[model samples]
Target chain A: MEEIKEIMKSHTLGNPVRLGIMIYLFPRRRAPFSHIQKALDLTPGNLDSHIKVLEKHGFVRTYKVIADRPRTMVEITDYGMEETRKFLSHLKTVIDAIHF
Target chain B: MEEIKEIMKSHTLGNPVRLGIMIYLFPRRRAPFSHIQKALDLTPGNLDSHIKVLEKHGFVRTYKVIADRPRTMVEITDYGMEETRKFLSHLKTVIDAIHF
Candidate 1:
């Protein structure tokens, strides 16, 4: 059962863009669109679409804050953390195997 | 170095159709095109293209034999075996997590 979740995590994180999002979000806990966009060098529309999918899957959470101006931020959920761990472990396994 | 190869293997096998082909071929040493097509319930053209890709990648070997009739049989190679193991392990992790 746990193993299956790991595979789903791997499959989800298989894409470079999606994986980059998770890697970025996993550490800091939360970030805004600009932060991620700048880090990954992806266009706004492309990053937005993938973030929406991750949000839909409950792997990420989004919050809109109003202090002086409207701000949108995203964070990894508990579910996302577990998923990320599995993905990283699997990724580590793969990276460990590269010869040249 | 080894780790990177493993990741490449996982990335390569991430596609469902390709995964199915490796799964089918791993158990049996060799099989003909029609056999794989029927077993996987895939169309001939679909199976053929994927098989061509697998053959090109050195993951599979295709042999042509003539006795009374010409026969084409495909087998998983050593490289394919290592790749298949990683894919299966990764797959097991995913199946283990599916709930409901």
Candidate 2:
């Protein structure tokens, strides 16, 4: 329960949007901003704000990539990956502890 | 993500202590106040406050049971059981969606 409380209070993943962004980026490592916005069904402005929060927490980095056109990309930092992993593992522990 | 957000915003289980209380009572259905306090490592006053919130939400009912002595026992209502089950199921979905 203490662990769950701590996880819930996490600065980076406390909000649902940020948590969704992190979960989406955890496996892929990096993704285009547009792709994330589409996948999460968030507007550009909303995603940007949440991404800023994640960046401020050192959980993610955003930069522009030049391909056919200039596009924004969001990538999870190593620290972010580790923290997300720990959160998920602790959550699994809590879930498993419940017998029924 | 929406489901996760809804669960996080739940009035009864939003707080960690109340969530812990629900999880602890889900299986047992009913438990003594002292046992809950001991199990969750919460102060008597702290547990009382959380229990009051749960009761107000119609999640639990507290009453005195006179066995050897009068002891306050907390029991989960059917509504609480249903809501807790839904919360756990939604959480499981979110966890399963993460394929890292």
DockQ per candidate, 2 decimals: 0.10, 0.24
In terms of lDDT, model 2 sits at 0.81
Candidate 1 local lDDT, A1-100, one digit each (tens): 2332233335466554676677667767889877888766778898899889888888898889887888788889999888877666654443334331
lDDT tens digits by residue: candidate 2, A5-66: 55545656655567678877898999999998887787899889989988988999989989
Native interface contacts retained, candidate 2: 0.11
User: What lDDT would each prediction earn against the true structure?
Assistant: 0.68, 0.81
| Backbone clashes in model 2, listed as residue pairs | none
Q: Please give the distance, in angstroms, between residue B5's alpha carbon in candidate 2 and its true position after superposition.
A: 8.0
DockQ, structure candidate 2 = 0.24
Evaluated at residue A56, the lDDT of candidate 2 is 89
Tens digits of per-residue lDDT, candidate 2, B1-100, equal: 5765565456566555677788889989999999999877878998999899999989999999999999999999999999888877776777877765
C-alpha TM-scores of all predictions: 0.53, 0.68
Predicted candidate 1, C-alpha RMSD:
7.8
